[model samples]
Target: MKKFPLLALAFCLATPAFAQSTQTTADLANTVKYRHAYQSMTKLPDWVAKATAVSVPAETLKLDGKSYLVGHLCKPHDCGDHQLDIVFSEDGKAVWGLLSRRYGKTLYQMPLGEPNTETLAALTASYHKNNPDDLAK
Candidate 1:
């Protein structure tokens, strides 16, 4: 597909070993970059800013011509215990998308489309496992 190159660019900008990073954000999951954006309190569409929030960068991905950060997001009251898919623009200045599953628990990974429940569950487990510091909090 014509979108493949943009995906590749996202991968490269994020990391070469990104794919092998347990299919998760891993060490970079809840890093400063993610925290800064979270602290920035940006929201997508009708989504409101939660009083408590944390983001784990799953990977850098792309949509259309813009590079975006794909990650697991958690909001104490809103998202509860389940991790949700959240997308941020490359500059970390805006929320590109938020797969809150307001209709269902489905998560959209962009370019590739929505992932099945099983895959999304595994990704969430990996996210918690990879980012223990956050889990402890």
Candidate 2:
């Protein structure tokens, strides 16, 4: 009886994450290559790097004839609640990005704008429901 309740409790606690995985998977893809991914991640904007709470290593992704690497950001380091998505040039030479979970729409990489689907999916999976405006576009 005791073992049964413990097993049930663990599954119940983990249910929400499983429920949300499908939604997140629909959002996107990226895998960071080991070599130089760390170097590339270091090129993020001053505000972004300083603000990052949890940092995932950079992943190399090819898009639109450009070689790009993406870094994930969660929670601001200042102990405030905020999120960001950052992308870097493979050589650590420059940064390219317009990620979801950010403060504003403007970016240094693509000055004009891009399709919302491409931009928003760059963020964490939870962004989908929270940022309806991003999905609508």
lDDT of all predictions, in order shown? 0.51, 0.51
lDDT of 2: 0.51
Tell me the tens digit of each residue's lDDT in model 2 across 1-118: 8999999999999998787544333233233443355556545555564753565676776766777676655554531234455656668776544443343553222211332454
The sequence of per-residue lDDT tens digits that candidate 1 reaches over residues 1-137 is: 97999999887889955657553454454677676666454343233345145655478554566676666765555554334555556786655333443334333332113444543454454455544655665
Q: Mind sharing the TM-score for model 1?
A: 0.29
Question: In candidate 1, residue 29 scores what lDDT?
Answer: 41
Off by over 4 Å in 2: 1-52, 76-81, 99-137
Clashes of 2: 1
Superposed by TM-score, candidate 1 places the C-alpha of residue 75 at a distance from the truth, in angstroms, of: 3.0
Name the lDDT of candidate 1: 0.51
Candidate 1, position 5, lDDT: 96
Q: Estimate each model's TM-score.
A: 0.29, 0.35
Q: Residue 133's C-alpha lDDT in candidate 2?
A: 61
- Cα lDDT, model 2, residue 135: 58
In angstroms, what RMSD does candidate 2 have relative to the true structure? 19.5
